[model samples]
Target chain A: MKTVLIFEPLDFSAKVIATLTEHGFEVSLNKDNISIREALEKYSLIYMRLGVKIDAKLLDECNSIKCRFILIPATGIDHVDEQACYKHQIQIISFKNKKELLKDIRATAELTMALTLTLLRNIIPAIESTKSGIWNRDLFRGRDIFGKKVGIIGYGRLGSIVSNYFHTFGAIVQVYEKNAVELPSHFERASSINDIFLNNEIITLHVDYQESNIQLINSSNLMLATKQPVFINTSRGQLVNEADLLVALENKVIGGAAIDVVNEELGFNPKNPLVAYANHHSNLIITPHIGGCTIDSSHKTEEIITNELLDLIKNEV
Target chain B: MKTVLIFEPLDFSAKVIATLTEHGFEVSLNKDNISIREALEKYSLIYMRLGVKIDAKLLDECNSIKCRFILIPATGIDHVDEQACYKHQIQIISFKNKKELLKDIRATAELTMALTLTLLRNIIPAIESTKSGIWNRDLFRGRDIFGKKVGIIGYGRLGSIVSNYFHTFGAIVQVYEKNAVELPSHFERASSINDIFLNNEIITLHVDYQESNIQLINSSNLMLATKQPVFINTSRGQLVNEADLLVALENKVIGGAAIDVVNEELGFNPKNPLVAYANHHSNLIITPHIGGCTIDSSHKTEEIITNELLDLIKNEV
Candidate 1:
């Protein structure tokens, strides 16, 4: 049996572990904070999470090792060194490549809606005040999402799902996607990004992160906003300029913001501008990149990855 | 011109006030904390809000005075003294009788959905922790509302609207309404309240407050919640027994609860068990009764009530 190195606390279900064991893999769950070098020499297969960054230096360490396959139990491959893996003759397997595993992307879209609703309704202050033994409902008189104009930055699976939700809630949804696709009858297509910012009362970003897309929502683009809109970003953090967002919030350029991902999310940096701004402002809601982190989505992803790994092992044998 | 006494800060829009003034009513906007006796004797018409209790004593005072009509600028007339109004020949006019005015009941329904989503996603704690500069995404792994069984206690206007929202989110909506009306094709009718409690992952109350409906969600009925569902209430606070709800939270009989209304909401009672419990427990989220308090809803209701009041004045002339 091939020895498989499992990273501790990766949110993989017991069923996933059992499936690997049943498939005749000697799964050694590692708890010690040892270097990637030690694990590469001992095991031919490594199972890790997205939080464990596999950079170029770590990939270089796998040059003279028994390790051949690196499996990530997430949809994002941003943390992993793809070029280094190819150079080292090592194969990278992630849920990102498996389209079937990504069927439950609604979890991310739902979180976007939840955060958006929380911002619009002033729910955080309302709850905080109630907890402090205050019954001042008048202070929390919020604006209704009904008949509000919502601008979506992407029209992919997740963006379309979110657009449908807002539309169902009586929000007029407008999309500013690069690709022209057949949208639902209710959703209007924005002519440009400026059209989305100028007209929409609420704007949410769901575009994929790329090198060119870095800091896409900078100060100049944010200044295009005409209506005091509540901004939401459940997508990649690098897509937004954190400093510009903070400035917009301080100047009241935007009505509010709900950010699930931040630029410095990998580490808990207390001095992160978005984090510091959110600490002081009740209107800015920050969640630590848990948009896709739902029990159902996690379990489904685990099942797909586990099955895919078993198939890969069989093909290799 | 009939002298109409306006209550201070009743969320009535400026347009509503202008409509009354234009219609030849001498609108006296009062600010001093004067007695109902002064209001009855000085003014022919009294305009009040939901917070002001118009009991038998106030009605008796109107009997000896020029006051002819008691106008409430809201849907619920539970606070007004109906029998005393009849004896004193004081006409009780409210937005409750105006169907056109109630078109924007979506605000309350939207609040209900917001609270429900907040509970399911553990958003309160997520925000609290994030504000404290913590970026622990694993701690906020929420469950998806999709494919979850949601039990709605009423099938009236607000309840049906909420039901549609949950159903659109891919939740199986089972409703328990006393009167069987034509329901949407997607909704499943629960034979009894017990069915709702026994087989649902989420439960929300939308019943009107009445004599027989007091403490509708008592300990016994709450204990029947086999799924440990997240309970939500944006309706009348008197409909729930706060002590029973607190017990449910402490015992983990239910998954969690998000309450916008409580039985003792008329005043801020720090000793209220629900408030006290929420202070310590993150699972329980409390918002002080702001269900129908959206800016859009308030303005729309005000417009409708103002038009209705004008029609009434024209009829009297």
Candidate 2:
């Protein structure tokens, strides 16, 4: 009988356990086991999502696992220790994880659009004034999103989703990718990253956090972006050079930004220039990485995870 | 041939003039002439939109061409001088101005969705923080929109359009209307307005500002809303009671409000409780009426006016 240990609590984990348990596989759930010491006791395989760290400190105890396989339940490889797995001669398996991906991407894209719209409409200032009992139309007057151009990087799921919405709203949405990807008929694909830089009034990043992609939106790249395209990233924070983003925002190189993922997921320092700027300026929007965390999507995610684990254990899929 | 004297500046006034002029009717363009006396002396008909007052002063000066017709190109009749027209016996002719109603309704619906999304994702505060060059996710952490029941009042074009978008985003949408309306297959109409008030997490008003509907949302009505329902309105300001809305907002009868229409349209004053409350709280968001003022929509407004006038002149419709 095969055994699998999930290092983190996944959505729908109960169903996944049921699928596995009824199938005669020994399954150990690890909701509290974030560290490597707890991981060392795993069986033949492992499954995990965000928040679990698979780093060198924990890899030292890998010999005790007697596990043959390692699994990453999502696309990003940030938390997984690939080199450690290779050295341990463990087979690695990864799923596209569409349920999580779709939810996260959709949530992120939707939030981005919301941010852009609110920013354009001066919704915050208006809210602030209304609270203050002030009705300064001058402070809250806003533009609409009917004819603006939006540049989207990483024409994957989230980017594509945002594209569909913006296009529907009559925004000219352009997307870019290192590899060719088919977009919905309405979206315009830009061949070069530079083209997205030149033409878009708003630039959103949805690409994976490849090293090459990391710091990709640093000083020079942001400088290339014409007149402050509202920079957005829901994928990974490192894809943009936060330091450079700060300078650009400070200097008005980009018009504004709406970011869901932050480079420092640990905590934000108000002392930082960007952090300080976000305090006073009316254009920059920063959210902790919460794109896929909507209660609606989260409920769906829980269901998918449970079913996937159940099927795998039961040999149903 | 009958003629209508429309006021200064509309989107397609030129086209309207061309439509009416080329059809063998003498043209009395208002851009070149602002004198009501001159207009009354020349033209027999007048087209109306917003911004121009048609009070007793303007209606008193008609002589040359028997007060033939007052054609309102827009839906709302609030701008028309009804008493004056009635006294002078100027025949008012208007089919339901479907184009203006639908276009404005659609735009308003879109704005409501946009506002709702922004509020849920904390986009306004985030944007303001970002633009000021700060990153404060703590202050702006927000909830997702899924699982929330959205109550739509007056399910006409605006209400219906917004409901469709909300449904797509995975919200449970309910509607309340005085007239039995045929909704798309996916929607379920609440048996009564209280059904929406009791069940929904959000309340959006699309009711027009007629005498009967004024103050429809008074103290008791506002009290009917449950679970801190966020209130949104793009319809006329009079549909909601100012004092009742303020009390509801202050006492947490509803969660918060996002309004584009206010009882005080000229502006909010120090004496207004809404203004006073808004200055101290962050939940209320107020916008100057610009939901349908997007560039694209504005162009469409002009097109509608121009095309309709041309059709009438050419007797094409």
Candidate 3:
């Protein structure tokens, strides 16, 4: 029997396990996060999520290279050591560039709108105030999304979905993308990045993470935001300069920000300026990278990845 | 000279004041919330919002009725003493049934969507958790609105707008209204109130508040919510029975609730069960009746009302 070890089996559906078992694969569940070395010695195939990082050092510790397949049920492969896996002749399977499979994966786009709505409506403070038995509506006066000028940084899948949502709410959406393409008649194509920052009332980032675009929203582009637009980042933490964002928020250079990712996201860093600032001020709202943390999205992604893995194993047999 | 006393002049814009001044109508702002008797004794016209209550007792308290007009820049006239105004021939001018003037007044609808997004995304607790230096995304796993069935009660202006927003977010929308009307091809017309509560995963209320329909969402109808749907109320507080909602929430009869209005809105009542429950539990979220509170909405309503008032006064002169 072909043996497979699933790290972080909490969210893995029973249907996937049953399907694997039916196909003559003995699946071992890793509930307590056992050592990778032990797992490598036991199973030839491994499945993991973003929470568990597969680095070079961890791979080096495993003397016996029994693991030949690493299945990741996600689009991004940053959590896995791709170069190390390539050298070890281990194939990594993921949902990267699977357009048809990802057409309905809209949790991230939904969360982007959620963050924008919460910040624009002052929902957090307003609810807190009501919880404290105070009924002062004046203190939590917020701007309406209707008739506002919104700029989307990337015209990708999530970006287009979010911009369409804003457009449905009567907002004027302007999109900036590297790839030149025709857009809907209502949405304007911005000339440059500065045009998005300078002209719009709210700006959101949706570009993919790349080494060349690290710290994409630094002081230079942020300074051109004359409208004091509310900044939103649901893309990647590395895309923004944390120190520059902190300063921009403190000086009121931007209206406000609602972020789903941060630079110091792996561990609790006491000196994280954004988290510290969010604690004291209402101008900033942060979530712990939950842009795609919906149960429906998880189930769909898991089902697709597990079926694809089954297909690969069947071919090998 | 016609003298007008604005009871709650805090939100009264300078443009409205200047326009009133331009029309030769003397505007006196009552910033301190002066006595109703004093205001009635001096001014020939009174302008107020929802904060101030005009009742029969207040009308009787004034020995002589000098105020001839009560101008309200809103659709609801429940705050004013209509019977007393009629007896004294004091005309109560409001935007009631003025569809043209209210075409773009969409603050309440925007707030409805905001509250829905916040509750569905678990954004309030997620932000609080992140602020406490926790990065566990699994702890705050929320349902996506993309494929959820959302039932909207009352297909009025605000209700239709909110339903459209949810539909745009990829939600299945079902609407229930009193009058038989033609709907769009995508929207499903719910057979009855029970159809809305029984079949949907998320239900929202947007019915107009009337004496005949007080306590509309009582325990009887709430019991039919088999899906434990998230209940949203952005309409009048009196439309829902607060005591019953508290019971439903405590027993988990409903998934959760996000309410912007409450029964006891005027005074700080310690016994408000919803507010008390919201303080300790995450299932309920409350806001201080801020549905119609937005700078843009306020400006538009004020401008339209002020212009109409000027026309009336000019014709009288």
Candidate 4:
């Protein structure tokens, strides 16, 4: 049988599994963390998520293996070393270029809004207060997003969606895109990143992960937060300097923050300053990287990727 | 000097206080829970919020008092006995008739959407998990609001705002308004309240409180929730039957619920079953009545009502 290895446990529907089996494929799911390189040697196709990092060394070790395709059912392929995949001639299939498939995938954007509201409204501690048998609304009065100045770092797929959401809620949205992208009529284009931080009350990051843009939000830009904006990041953990974020929260340079990604998220350390700060502070809310961890998005993406993969395999045979 | 008593503690700006004092008004803020009837006997104008329950008995006892006007810095007149006010010829000054002023008060609506996303995204527990040094995303996979059926009860001010918000998030919105109200072209009007519960994946209440509509969401209508919708109530505590709601949550008749209001919110008893259930289970999320508690809303409403009361007093003098 044609061998397939799902390197990460994902919610694949029964129908998708049945279809793959009928097509002469033996599907094996990785229940426990195992060596991906060894599995790649035995399996011709490997289905993976963000859990495993496909670095240059791993791809080099599996270069001579039967692994021909690395199937990633997500938009960002930053987890996979694209340069190394090209060197090994292994095909990396992802939803990065598939705009049609990703148009309906709003999990990440939804979480961005969720984090913003949760942070702004003090929903976390408020819920905790109510759960602890206290009902003091005075203690947890929240900031209004309505008529507030919200700054968007990147006007890409997720950014645009979030900008629209904030705008609908009566917020004045300002965009700061590095590469020139057409903005909606209502959105104000920030002159510079510093201007964005200086003017807005809420700042969110949604930039695609790139080496050039690493540590994009640091002390330099964060220092210009004159309005003390609530910083939100749902993109990648490497995008912001967590150390600088800790300083900003401590000094009240920014109002607060809600983050879904951490720098060392794969094997997240509790020792991270931001995580530790979030444990005690009401300003910082840290969710377990659940931006795209929705059942609806998972099922749809899995089914679509599976069908597409089957078609490609059929064509090759 | 004209006497005025602020019966409830509110965030009145320094400018407002200056303005009141400059206009020959002797303002006294109630520092303790003194009897309103005694205060009424001394002060001609009394400012209040929802903390005090104004009934016919209290109004009758204070009927012969010098108090001629009740200044409520809120929209809801349900807390005050409107009939008694009319019977005693005491004018009620509130935001109920100020559509122009209320157009910008989006705090409650924002909170409604906040609660919905918080519940649907499993944000509270996810944050707690991350705080406790757990990074398991699988444990908190959320449901998407996108492409889900959302049923909105009441298409009034707050209800319509929430409907528009849900629709913007890609939800198919179905509104159930008891009285005839014009809905947007995109929104579907439900045949009955029962039909709304049966069809939608998420249900939110925004209806006004009325004696006729007490316990509107009981076991009778909750039984029809075939989709097991997440119940959201930001409207009023009295609109839902607490006993029936507890039973629905326990039986899984409804998916989960996030409520900002409880029936016994005034001096709230934490012994309530919903509060007790929320302490243990992740399904029920209870927030203190923070729906209208926003800095922006509070400031704007206070200023508006204070100024309006001053204008009335000026005209009467």
Candidate 5:
């Protein structure tokens, strides 16, 4: 029987170990502290999460052994050393390859809507105040999202989903995607980025993090906003200049902000100016990067990976 | 010119006050401290909110004077002495009479959605943790509302609207309305209230507060909730017994709760069990009675009242 090794605890309805065992593979679970040399010697197939860095040293150890495949139960493979894996002739299988698997990637979009509604209604402060034994209803007089103009900065999967959500809630949706495609009839396309900023009362970014996209919402673009819009960034923290965002929030150039991702997220120091501002200002809501971390989404991803691994093993046999 | 006494400081756009003034009415704005007797003697028309109670004594004072109309810029007239108003032959005009006026009452429905999303995502604790310098993403793994079964307790204006919102977000909506009307094509009408509690993962109450409906969600009905649903009450708090709710939450009979209104809200003591529990438990979210207090909703209501009052004056002339 082929030995399969799982590197982390997975929470899914499907019994992965039992399924692999029934398929004639001996499965072993390992803690993070397990030696790479020992793991490679025992298991030919490996499953791990994206947070487990598959660096060159680990790749070298795997290449010297019978390791044939590395199954990642995630969309991103940035943590893995791709060149080393290719050189070692180890096949990489990820959720990204299974186009049909991510049909319902609504978790991120749901979270974006959650954050948007939280900011719109002053829910965080309201909940905080309520918990603190104060029932100050007057202090939390909110604005309705209905009839508000919402600008979606990207027209990708998540952005389109979020746009649909806002539109369903009676907000007029405007879109600005550089790689233009046919849009739904209800969504009005903005001619330029400035058009979105100038026309909309709420703006949310869902663009991919690229070198050119860094600091996309700087002082110049923010200044063009005719309406002091509540801004949301669930895409990437680098997409907006943190300093500029803080200044805009402080100066009341923008109505408010909800930031899920931040630049240097792993090294997010409490002393950061944005973090400091978020601590004090009720207008700003800072959530740790958890847009796509819902239990449903994670379970779906795990199921897809498990099915794919079973099929791969069957084909190999 | 007929005198009009505005009872409170209204923050509506300049248009509402301007339109009222243009209609040949002498308008005088007064603080809440203004004497009712003094105001009735000076003005023929009066504008005030529901908070400014018009009891029998105040009604008698108005009856002895030239006050012709009591214009309440609200939906409810429970604050006014209806018998006295009728005895004095004074017309009581409210937003309810003007059907076209409240074509879109979106604020309460919007707040309901906000509270629902906040609870599902554990946003309160997430924000609190982030602000307290703890970046714990693992602690805040949420569940998607998409594809969840949601039970709506009432199918009236607000309940219907909230049902539509949940349906749009991909939740299967089950409704239980006592005044059983023909439901929309999409919603599944539950055979009984217990059916709603038994099957759905989420339950929201939008029922009117009445004598018989008090303690609707007591221990008996709460035990019927097999799904351990998150309960939301944006309606009057007296509908659910506070002690029962706290017990259910503590015993995990319900997954969570987001309460906007509470019994004895005017005399909300911090020592209340529900309030005390909310302060300790992240599962419970409490908001002051600000469900319909959005700036947009207030402005819309004000505009509708102002227009109706103007038409009433014109008709009288």
Candidate 6:
């Protein structure tokens, strides 16, 4: 039987290894040595997170090991060499089913709403301001989220849930989806990508991690947007061209942005380009890409993966 | 016929002022000077904001000012000298009708939901983090409002609307009204204040401004509730005792707080006790007392006051 391996460091789901093992398949977790290329010959199936890059060299080793499947245990497959996988005849599966993540998606959508209101009302600044014992209510004469135009790109799970908030708040909800898929009965769909840019006062991205959706919000889309829209990217970092996003904020193409993902090659720090832009632009709000986070979501994600692995080992295998 | 003189500082509504002018009342707005004593003798009805002090001296000057009806623009009458008004036989006519601020209350309740969701999911922080390009997705994990327990301390107009958000989020909603007043059908009213404090995961205060509801959430109340409930106050400033609240955060008596009001003599500033507390504690959030501050709410408030003043001038006279 083929062996399976998980190299990604995670603080959850202990049952995955046990389930795969029950199927009479040899299984081992690369906790001590996570360098995939060096250890590729040992496993037929491999799963890992974004930071651990799997390139052509790893694919060659996997072929030597007669590997049949490469599972990237995340939503985005930016770190994996897809062409290499194809050449090696490795079947690839990335991202959980959308229905599986609906609860978490709703959480992420709700988080975006919270952040938007906090930013608009200057709640953080007000909190910071009051820490020093100064009363500045007038300074925090913040605007309400009600009746604002909110544009959502990638009308998938997260985008759809966010639209509900906008609608409830009396905001005009506009959605941008490349597929032109029929949306929920309640939502107002954006006719085209340009339409999302043209009509929305605030824009949020919720597209999944297919190749087409990657880098979807580039300079052209920013230019196409009508009144400078407030951009948000909780979907994935690769979906937005960070440099262009920064430029958009700097050059005033968009009003501001609230980001949850960015290019990992850029690194996460105070001096990062987007961070630099956010600091200067009071309008921009940044977060450490926590849309998929939340203790409950993490636990649930692990449970789902483990259960799936168990089912495959117990019956499908 | 009584020549009722009206001294209001801001611009009078065309319709409202017209009603007074067309009737027997003579209206004068203080555009040049802000002398309370001088303005008192010239006006029978005094319209004022937080800045104006309707005291004994002013009331004595307006002794001949029949009815001595003082119309306060906002709900809270902390600024109004009630003792002086009573001694001088001033009939304080605030809003006996909650209908006057129904629009505003609804707006505020929706706003509170927006802010609460934002804070709970680290949405604002995520925005700031993302804007800065940090993309620390792991750091910004947030919880959804769904399946949570939300408690409303005072189930008046604002509380009823807020409770509705919890219901929409699929959360269990409970309310505690000191007077045992029944709330909306959706709301599950607590038989006692202890029940709310005992079971609720998130507690919001919406009691009216009066002696009965003052300092309602003291050390004892905080002790009875869940160890950590998302706390919010959009009612009176003095309702939650500041010292007790500060201690609650310090001891982790509650999970977090989102404040719209505070007990302070100096007014709101960035460097207040609550602000100081928020900085030290990750879960504390403080917004200026602006629950009813949406564009929709402001416009509604304008209409309500306009209609009320106009009706009083024309119909009463």
Q: Which candidate should be chosen as best, given lDDT against the real structure? A: 4
Chain A TM-score by candidate, in order = 0.93, 0.80, 0.95, 0.93, 0.86, 0.79
* Prediction 2 global C-alpha lDDT: 0.67
Q: lDDT by residue for model 1 over B1-317, one digit each (tens)?
A: 78988764556577877877887888877778566778877888887766667778876655367788877767667878788777877787776645455755578888888888787778888887887888887888888988899999998778888898898888999999999688888889999887898999999998877788999888888888888999999888889888888887788888899988877766669778887788888788889888878888877776776677678867877
Model 4: colliding residue pairs: none
- The digit string of per-residue lDDT tens for model 6 on A135-235 reads 54546555555667888877666676778767766677877777657877767877777788888777888787767777787888888766777776777
The sequence of per-residue lDDT tens digits that candidate 2 reaches over residues A1-317 is 88778765444346656766776778877666546455655577776555556666677755475766666545576767778877766655554535343454255667767767766665666666555555554444445555678888887667766776676665788888787666777788898777888888877787877777877778877878775677777778878888888888788888877677767654445465655666677787566565655544544454555555555545744
Better of 3 and 4 by DockQ: 4
Preferred candidate (lDDT higher): 4 or 6? 4
Arrange candidates by TM-score, descending: 3, 4, 1, 5, 6, 2
**C-alpha TM-scores of all predictions:** 0.94, 0.71, 0.96, 0.95, 0.91, 0.80
Clashing pairs in 5: none
Top model number, TM-score: 3
Provide the lDDT at B63 for model 6: 37
TM-score for the second chain in candidate 4? 0.92
- Per-residue lDDT for B114-143 in model 2, tens only? 777765665655555555545444455455
- Tens-place lDDT per residue, model 3, B1-317, is 88989877766778888888887789999977787778877898888778767788888787898988888888877878789887877888888777577878888998888888788888989999989888888888788888999999998888888989999989999999888878899999999888998999999998887887799999998888899899999998999988888888888889999999888677757558788898888889999988988878888888898778767867987
Score chain B of candidate 6 by TM-score: 0.80
Interface RMSD of each: 1.4, 4.3, 1.3, 1.0, 1.5, 3.6
Candidate ranking (DockQ, best to worst):
4, 3, 1, 5, 6, 2
lDDT of residue A94 for candidate 3: 90
Model 5 RMSD in angstroms: 3.0
Cα lDDT tens digits for candidate 5, A196-304: 8899999999887656898898888887777899999888788888888888888888889998877766556777788788878888998887787788877777667
Residue B52 miss distance in model 1 (angstroms)? 2.2
